[model samples]
Target: MEITSVPFLNPEEYSLFCSFFQDFDNDGETSVNKSRKIDEKNKSLSEILEVIDETEIPTSKFEIPSSEFENRASEMGDWEQGRVRKGRNQSPATFHDGETAEDGGGQRRRLWVKERSKGWWKYLDSDECSDGEFRKAFRMSKGTFNMICDELESVVMKKNTMLRMAIPVRQRVAVCIYRLATGDPLRTVSSLFGLGISTCHKLVLEVCAAIRSVLMPKYLKWPDQERLQEIKTTFGSISGIPNVNGSIYTTHISIIAPKTNQEAYYNRKHTERNQKPSYSTTVQGLVDPRGVFTDVCIGYPGSMSDEQILEKSALSQRSKLGMLENTWVVGNSGYYLKDWVLVPYTHQNLSWSQHAFNQRLDELQMIAKDAFMRLKGRWGCLQKRTEVKLQELPMVLGACCVLHNICEMHNEEMDVELRFNLYDDEMELDSSRGISVNALQARDGIAHSLMHCK
Candidate 1:
């Protein structure tokens, strides 16, 4: 090709010549001094026409004008159109086609990245859907959900505005309740609630803590004197047992093996078919005649016997100190016979009055057992292996017990499936605690009264 030097070509002519080199491959780095001199003057059109006429340069190569080519010089190599995109300080040749050598080697360029998921909490919006959807999604009636939200608002609501907004207290409490009601894993709850996994975990703990601290006292407590009289009357109606203050029992909740003390949480009695320790936590409950929990003692290791749990409990302290007075709480053979605690005679031989006492005691025991059944039934989370950390499981279970009472107050229907298939922890006979002389006299007195009065 003949090269010609002319004072800059006219605008139109320069465009035409520049378009001709668009297909040339400009691959790999070249120093500034050795780089192509794109600013240099080019031959006039008349001179380029003479060269094209003499040489056999293919016409097909430059058929398409530069105006028609897409600018892909940043990442893709245009073999036909060899032009390369350039950095501000670096020449186009400083980077090979498709090589990520810009702004130093292989470091990722900063980008406007969005890490949040949008509108996951939308499911809780009442106006967006039907009441049935709300109940199914949150596992509670809208009214119940809102009531809980209102009560928890003061505690669960965020107080800071310093950073990204905190999750609304409603959503936070809902996440915790929904997890408990459904026994769903944290990941599932997080996805359903449109929260991060860590956020969901935090919310569960926070909400449970709030429920334990705020609602538990209001819902689950030792009945006052008047309430105690009412409870005794209810028990009397169920069976002829007199002075029955409450019924007591224990149920074990499954948990993952603890990292701190694996053996402590291991309930040897709950061994798998292969005889492996099944780790669990025990929740001991005292229920009124209506099958509502009045008192709950949670966080006892499953390995601890029921009598041990009861002896160490506040209820026992209250009873031993004469706080209960004439009031007597009934349990199965698992508890020691005490002046304030009545257990059915487990001896093989029995008098007719003793037989009558045992029968009435069995009825009272069923009331407490059924309370646990209804509790675990209503909140299926306790039925399954609770995935919460061992330390947090106490508050979580305590919260569920409180909710159980609230649900009972509101007449929340028991889950039919769980009601029939309720789990009952086996009871052990602790008859060796040596029945109190006063307790034995009281039991015989009640039995004699029942026999003669009837």
Candidate 2:
């Protein structure tokens, strides 16, 4: 017997065979009957294949003539040209080349650069540019723009989750205020960002309130005994005194009034037609020699006398404590009180008064004057209202004192002259009007003798 081999079917033929077999139901239990049916189908398929292989047709039987072929080609060309013409007529006017479309009865289209004049390019709206030209003209970095857009999208999504309505404009306005308080000018800030001046002003006030509510408690603190001791040690070197006595400085307030009279102005004075006296709030602050603000009292009427302000100040109570029994305090003649506070150069010397008591009192006055002169050099006249309101004034004064003490401490031998001018230009003596100077001098002499014996 001779062995024969059959060639494998190509991909197309195998696919077709698989498709035919896929239609059969394999769930039937009659295996013999199913096999017989499959054999019959295979026989039919083989016979069809054999017929297709053996069949032959005449090439010229169904061929068209060359003239007919050319005629069909021309018909196709005509049909295509007609279709193109129909398309051009039905399309939008905006889509047509070389024709500008009006805004009415058509979509508004951006004008191209070539359609515009040379100078008109400068005035061209941003919407009129190609994507590339717009990006270049705006000078935006691709990465930065995308990152900003993404961040905005994320913020919008987060906001929408909790809010049913849009976020209010004031909530965004608050952000502007924060920038202003932290040191940004309102004019330069919102101009580029498209915000109005009034909005910026309100925002600044709101932010200031918020920050003050949080920060005021921590930064504004009262000084304790420890801090007072520290201040004493710091001022001691400069004053050449073993301990520090209290001091007081005075300042005034500024009142602003319009140059021209307005409806708001009411003239209290009937005689003086042009005179309008302005008014301002008066503030008094008591600070230690080290410039640590010990107490502050505000809301005194501008016309209140300096003596009245001092009498009401917390320093008045401190002075009553008898701390000045052996110590000295620095102040102007405004604080000149006989018994409680020591007005400088008020003590009298007599024949019985030891020379040492007079010398010590003179030395103390000199030291106080020296400190005042140094303060005056650094701070000019504290009487000025505008300069006092500058927030850095207190800090500058404190820092200068610290530096002065440090210099005095490190350089002990350097002799510096005391430079304060006395407030009273002339000494007044009235022997008959009051306790005679001679009697006061005798009392001081006795006190000094007793002090030396002790």
Candidate 3:
């Protein structure tokens, strides 16, 4: 009630206090009427507190002695104390359309300012950053990144608000890309992108979802009738294997050992061979002649062999329904010999024709292997164990595969530094050697023709 006893008022506080005098000083009002007007104003206490909050008043200007507050607090009963926080915004001051100034939470939400660092992100986003630096940081050329952002803009874009502008789609995408490219922890990504750690994590998942839903169906999909014919012709020239639609390979992406059914995700082969613990999920990809994935099956447990993964894959289901239509997809010895699938012989002794056939077929398989290497290399998230949960790993993996296809389609070359040996320290799946009666004849015919031609 006494301005002289209080510290200095900021402009908002000064204006607020001045309004009381301007209202109460009007001449003909009874005490009861004046009190009722004051009560009506108090009904908008929530919004008034908000206006006060916008003024960054120095704490030093408002500090009260601890002993004075302690003495007052000791005198207050529970009902009075609770009243300090009650009934705000219940009869809010509304605008023409009845919108209130503050949220429905009233005074329940804590008021504080968060200071986020922007130095790293600022440099990375500026012209002073060299092309090499930008590429190294985000693992893609500026053009490629821009193209991806444009493709996802409609879905990944957010609406702005009165309090703060929404982060631009490019920046949101950069946060996601940097996280995926470097396999950085959310803490590091947050600092680099000037975002909260949880925000960084959320951006990656959101962008990955966008990529899966929007870009993946366009960039990564099974070949059509014409595309299949082209692929078969290309494979025929490479290894004299006719009707070879694509080369398929399965690779494991490392993940945190999940709590439920840990053994299911355990890689016994990798653990035994490397003499250490390992956990992963399987990603089976069928790549065309240019090493771009046309079909991918992701999120199978790491313990599943390539044969088992293939069986569970959509590719197998389609093949069983005669969708493949007598075309062949070649895999290594880890897969079973089937009418629509070809595998290299794995016995200790092999005839000259069988070895020749194996070598030629292996050349096609290597296309897929090399593609996997570049996929892991360019998207570093797939190289190391990721923090994404088991259930959501599919979107992340599928996003990587789609991006890899986009890069390949664009003729984007991987910087030599990003090259990774996916096979190094990785154990191959045990061969399942299942045989089909008709497959042997098909393989024998191809091997004889190939041997004779060579």
Per-candidate TM vs. native? 0.72, 0.33, 0.75
Over 4 Å off, model 1: 1-124, 127-133, 136-139, 159-163, 272-274
**Per-residue lDDT value at 316 in model 2:** 67
List model 2 lDDT by residue over 332-391, tens digit each: 444443333333334456334334443443444444444444433322222222222333
Query: Candidate 1 residues 99-156, lDDT tens each?
Result: 2223345333322222544365574565777776676655567788889999989989
lDDT of each residue in 115-224, candidate 3, tens digit only:
57678877977889887788888777788888999999999999754234477898889998888788988888887777788888899999999999999989998888
Which residue window of length 10 is worst by lDDT in model 2? Answer: 262-271
Q: Pick the candidate with the highest lDDT.
A: 3
**Per-residue error (Å), model 1, residue 441:** 1.9
Among these predictions, the greatest TM-score belongs to: 3
Which ranges of candidate 3 are over 4 A from the true structure?
1-111, 424-434
Off by over 4 Å in 2: 1-196, 200-216, 241-245, 257-278, 317-329, 338-343, 346-454
As a TM-score, model 3 comes out at 0.75
Q: What are the Cα lDDT values of the candidates?
A: 0.75, 0.41, 0.83
User: In candidate 3, how many clashes are counted?
Assistant: 0
> Whose lDDT is higher: candidate 1's or candidate 2's?
1
